[model samples]
Target: MPDGAPADTVTQLRRDLAAAYRLIAHFGMDDGIYTHISARLPDGPGGEKRFLLNPYGLRFDEVTAANLVTVDETGAVVDDPYGAGVNAAGFTIHSAVHMARHDAVCVLHTHTVAGVAVSSIKEGLLPLNQWSAQFFNRIAFHDYEGIALNLEERERIVADLGEKQVMLLRNHGTLLLGRSVAEAVKLALNLERSCKAQVAALGMGQTPIVLPDDVAEHTAGQYQKMYDKMEGAGGKDPEWDAFLRMLETAAPGYKG
Candidate 1:
């Protein structure tokens, strides 16, 4: 385990969450020091809910396992060796899902250009291709309600999210929920790519060929079945493993 952290599950959670930040930056999905990717930590000995959040002022590329902040459900920093404060907006959004959706171990929010562009569209994410079809009928939408800083907005956010794994904060950006940090990263990557494709296709000024409803739903089912198989087999995600290997070379020191 990294220094200054308990030698237990939290250690691994920190590394995985930090790796996610690094990977998001490496893939150009990060928006400077804005946006947030959070992972719920195991309850403390006293059973208080806690989460791992990137420090508010640090760029995703600068986040390391040892520097990530640990906060309670109320957004107060419980552990901050570096004294890096958590973002209020991050707490508002992440806490909403974490409190309501016990299955969402990791919640990733992004403000990528493609994601924002797609979020502004009326149709939301169109099933323009295989990448886009993966979320067909599976994604949710929450209308933008200014910046997510008010605690009262949490209820509506959860209501809009329902049980969906992916959501587009209309006029804002994208939100993804995963059973683990790895799963969250995979979802964010695919979602970003899907948005990019949609933006490009729509910009071509030609009528885009959208997949039939049946075909789109069938494709989504295939993707979900594969994911369910992986989860049932003990959550060993191959794509996440591959990304960790890439990180070993591409953006080392996230585990520091």
Candidate 2:
């Protein structure tokens, strides 16, 4: 298990992260071998920060627990049994959040057509539906500055993200963070659906109905309350458990 981290902890983290990759693929959110889902590992020896990321060129469905690569904050491969290094752009985007936000244990980024469509829109993610209302006033936006290979852009990414858990990489895609793999998956799924709905609504060529600011804020508060209750109840997220069960039947062997 990578020096300072407990064996059981790392094992579970690998399985969880692998499952996230498979789920993203199953939901059609994956963009071939691009984009990424990363989980911050427990600090290694000497307080070195590390993360588990899918190897570059591996489709999400192929990300087995045993195959995921471990990398340091500098994006260097620390433990890559398959000898598959990570994508440089993925590292730049994920590492920025991992370094800046201690609360973001799992960082998920996607390039769905609907997500990019919404990102391209001037209004961004409007509260056009109940699902979209959950993100009202909570999502951040980062202007695109070409591909994210340049290390210097990390500072701007962090600054734009600020303290928000969800972000729209304008004209690029969607990004979100969660305290765990399950939470990240949940947020990504919801955000994708919200974007899809917005695109469909706007395509009708009619003025879409948007919730009032107060109502939208209230709905967002309600969602937060539900999340807080789940956290208070020992973090036993039943929805995440159900998703795991679905994954077991639909796409097994991710835990391998």
Candidate 3:
């Protein structure tokens, strides 16, 4: 039942994967175990592609790596029972990205309150400040497609994603992709914060400091360069790590 991973090989990673679920809970993101966060495990020596996911129907706090489902790139449940259980619906979103982006090691999606708010904003993400500047010229929006269960939607999603790393599924949620777990984790959290900022700015009816088009492009390039330096080496972000620990304390049984 260990999915072919040596017994000890999967333990630490299971904890890390579980921590991701717990962190999602800490951030007030999770729709009764509906949304998801997933990571592509490097292919084993056998040449099969494997990934980790929170099993279906389990509340975010109830997730544990040991219970994480291991699946193939095609969204097939190649591995036996793991995680809480696999949701076939997850293939709607995560499978597309996993199959489309070979470098997309970790993909995080959310349906948080602010995230959905920004997704519906007609003006979209404005360059209100440096925190959002990275997204100024980089966010892509996909029009609402009721429930995204269509396999064909994968092509449309990938088309919308293009070279951008952050996306908003209109009337749905936000998505972030990165080649490493740390990078992907930070990207999603940052995207959520950006959306939260946009919602707050709009609520006050304040004139947001939208950078000129040229300025937005320049700033995005600068931020991209800064991240490029730290790239895969993007270490464990202390904030996310601490958040995971906090979840452990608040929901002590989550890492079970």
Candidate whose lDDT is highest:
2
RMSD (Å) of each candidate, 1 decimal: 2.8, 1.8, 3.5
Note the Cα lDDT for every prediction shown: 0.90, 0.91, 0.77
Per-residue lDDT tens digits for candidate 2, residues 1-256, read 2347688888988999999999999999999999999999988778899999999889999999999999999889999977879886678999999999988879999999999999998889999989999999999999999999899999999999999999999999999998788888988999999999999998999999999999999999998887767656376789988988998998898999
Candidate 3 local lDDT, 1-256, one digit each (tens): 1346565656656676677777777777888968888887757568777888878788887786667888876667866464345777776688888878877867888898988998887877788877788787688888998997788898999999987778989988999887656566777777788888888887997776777888878888997876666563544456556766776668666557
TM values, all candidates: 0.95, 0.96, 0.85
* True lDDT of residue 109, candidate 1: 95
Better of 1 and 3 by TM-score: 1
What candidate 3 gets wrong by more than 4 Å, as runs, is 1-12, 44-46, 80-84, 233-256
Better of 1 and 2 by TM-score: 2
Best by TM-score: 2
Q: In candidate 1, what residue range of length 10 has the lowest lDDT sum?
A: 1-10
The pairs that clash in candidate 1 are none
Q: Give candidate 2 misplaced runs (Cα > 4 Å).
A: 1-5
Candidate order by decreasing TM-score: 2, 1, 3
Better of 1 and 2 by lDDT: 2
